[model samples]
Target chain A: MSPVVLWVGGLMLAAAAIIIVVRIERGPSMLDRTIALDMLVGVVIAALALWSAAAERTDLVNVLVVLSLVGFVGSVTLARFVAVEPEDEGRILTPEEVRAHDGRMRASLAKESKRRVGGREDAMRRAYPESEDPR
Target chain B: MSVLDWFASICFFLGCALNLIAAIGALRFPDLLSRMHAATKPQVLGLMLVMAGLAASLGSSQLTWKLTIVVLFQFMTAPVSAHMVGRSGYRTGKVREDLLVIDELTEDLDRAKSTPIPPSSS
Candidate 1:
C-alpha cells in the first residue's frame, strides 16, 4: 500500500474512532454504549487491518482475531446481564439530584428492612408449621 | 502501481468509508436498535472489505489463511452478538415502540406471558 492511501485510511479511521467515542460518552443507555463500543471495536479492527496491510505484518493478524472474539464476548456478556436502568440513571446527575436520589434510596431501604423484620417470624412459621421452632 | 495494488487501494478506501458511515449512524441514530443496525451491518461489511484488501495486498498463502480466519470469525459472531444486544434492548425497554412497524416479539411475549407453560416431564 502506498503512503498516501495509508494516510487517508488512517485519517478516516481516526475520525470514525472519535465519533464512536462521542457516542460512547453521550449514549443515554447502557445498551447504546454497548453498541457504540462494539462499533469502536470494529473500527479498531479496521485500523489494525489497514496497518497490517500497509506494513505486511502477519503478526498483527492474530491480534485482529483476538479483538473480534473479545468484542463479541464483551458485548454479549453486557447485554445478557444488564438490568433495566431508570431513564435518569444513564447520564451524569447534578449534585442536588444525587442527594435527593440518595435520600430516596435510603428511605426505601429502611422501609424494606422494617418490612422484612416484621415478616420474619411469619416466614419462619410458614416454613416450619409442623414442628416447634428450634429457637 | 499494479492492478492488484489498485484493487487493494479501492477496497481499503471503500472499507474506510463504510466505517465512517457506521460511526456516523451510531452517533446519530435515535435508539438502541437503530444504532445496533448501524453498528453491525456496515461495520461487518467494511471489515470484510478491509480483510479482503489485506489479503490482496499480502498475497501470501499463510497470511491469507489468517485473514480468512478473522473474517470468518467476524461473520459468525457479529449476528449472534447483535441478536443478543437487540433482544436485551427490547426486553429492557431501550427500543422505541412507536418506531417499530410491526412488533412480533412484543406480541409473542405478551401471548407467552398470558398463557401458562406446559409442565415439563423430568
Candidate 2:
C-alpha cells in the first residue's frame, strides 16, 4: 500500500478510536460501556491490519486472530455477568412509564388523604352533634 | 497507479469510514441494545473491507490465507458476541422497554412461568 493511503487510513481509524473512547468515558450504562469497549477491540483489529500492511509484517495476522478471540470472550463474559444480575434490570424507566408511576402514587396519596378527612369529620360529628346541625 | 493499489486504497478508506460511522452510532444511540447494534453491524463490514484491502496488497499466498482465516473468525464471532451482549443487556434492564415496539422475550418468559414443567424421564 502507498504511504499516503496508509496514513489516511490510519488517521481515519484513529479518529474513530477517539469517538469510541468518548463513548466509553460517558456511556450512561455499563452495557453501553461494554459495547464501546467491544468496538474498541474491533477498531484495534483494523488498525493492526493497517499497521501490518504498512510495515510489511504478515505475522500480525496472528495477533489479529488472537485479538478477535479475546474480544469475543470478553464480551460474552460481560454479558453473562449482566444477565444474572436482575436487580439492575429495570433501572431505566421510560418517560411515559415514569409519568404513569408518578400519577399512580399521587392518586394513592389523594385517596388516603380523603379517607383521613372523612374519618375526622365523622369523629367531629359524633363528638359534638350540635356542631353538625344546619344553622 | 496500478489498478490493485486503487482498489486497496478505496476499500481501506471506505472501511475506515464505516468504523467512524459505527463509533458515532455507539456514542449517540439512546440505549444499550441500539448501541450494540450500532457497534457490531457496521464493524463486521468494516473489518472485512479493511482486511480485503490489506490482502489485496500482499504478494504471498500464505499471507492471503492468513487474512482469510482472520476474516472467517471475525464473521463467526461477531454476531455471537453481539447476540450475547444484547440478551444480557435486555435481561439486566439496560434496555428501555418502552422504546421497544415488540417484546417477545417478556411474553415468552411470562408463558414459561405460568406453565408447569413436565416430569423428566431421567
Candidate 3:
C-alpha cells in the first residue's frame, strides 16, 4: 500500500468516526447509542486494517479479532438487558401523537359524561312518576 | 506501484467510502431500526473490503492467516450483534413504531405471552 492511500483511508475513517461520535452523543435512546457504538467498532476495525496494511504489520490483526469479539459481546449483553424495558421508557412520542392522544381521551370522557347524564335523566323520570305523567 | 498495489488501493478507497456512508446514515436516519440497518450493512461490507486490501498488501502466509481470522470472525459476529441491538431496541421501545411498515415481532410476542406456558421437562 502506498503512503498516499494509507493517509487517505485514515482520513476517511477519521471523518466517519467523527460522525459516529455525534450520533452517540445526540442519540435519544440507549439503543441508538448502541447502534452508533457498533458502527464505531466497525470504523475502528477498518482503521486498524488500513494501518496494518500501510505499516506491513501482521501483529495488529489480532487486535482486530479481539475488538470484534468485544463489540459483539457488548451489543448482545446490552440487548438482553434492555429487552424488558417498559413500553414508555425509551420511546419519544412526537408532539402530534401527544396531541392526538389527548384529543382521544377528551372525546372518550365527554361521551362517558353524556351517557351518565342520560342515565341520570332516566332515573329522575322513574323517581318522579308525576313529572313524566304530566299528560 | 504494481497492479496488486493498485488493486489494494482501490479496495481501500472503496471501503473507506462505504464506512463514511454508514456513519452518515447512522447520524441521519430517523429511528433505531433504520440506524441499525445503516450501521451494520455498509460497515461490515466496508470492513471486509478493507481487510481484503490489507491481506493482499501483506502477502505473507502468517499475515494472510491473521487477516482471514479477522474476516471470518467479523462475518460471524456482525449480523448477530446487529440482530441483538435491533431486537433490544424494539423490545425496549427505543424504535419508532410510527416509522415501521411491519412489526411482526410485536405480534409474535403478544401471541407468545397470551399462550399458556407448557410444563417444564425438568
Provide the TM-score of chain B versus the true chain B for each model in turn: 0.90, 0.89, 0.85
- Which candidate tops DockQ? 1
Q: Rank the candidates by DockQ, best first.
A: 1, 3, 2
What lDDT tens digits, residue by residue, belong to model 3 across residues A19-116?
99988878677777777888888888888888888887778888987987677888787777865555454555689998999999999999999999
Better of 1 and 2 by TM-score: 1
lDDT of 2 at B29: 82
lDDT accuracy of residue A2 in candidate 3: 83
Better of 1 and 2 by DockQ: 1
Segments in model 2 whose C-alpha atoms lie over 4 Å from true places: A83-135, B116-122
Give lDDT per model, in order. Answer: 0.86, 0.80, 0.81
- On lDDT, the stronger of 1 and 2 is 1
Q: Which stretches of candidate 1 lie over 4 Å from their true place?
A: A93-135, B116-122
lDDT string, candidate 1, B3-118, tens digits? 99999999999999899988998888888888888887655789888988998998898888888888888888888889889888887888898888998977877777777893
**Candidate 1: docking tier:** medium
DockQ (CA atoms), all models = 0.62, 0.47, 0.51
lDDT for A5 in candidate 3 is 89
* lDDT at A16, model 1: 92
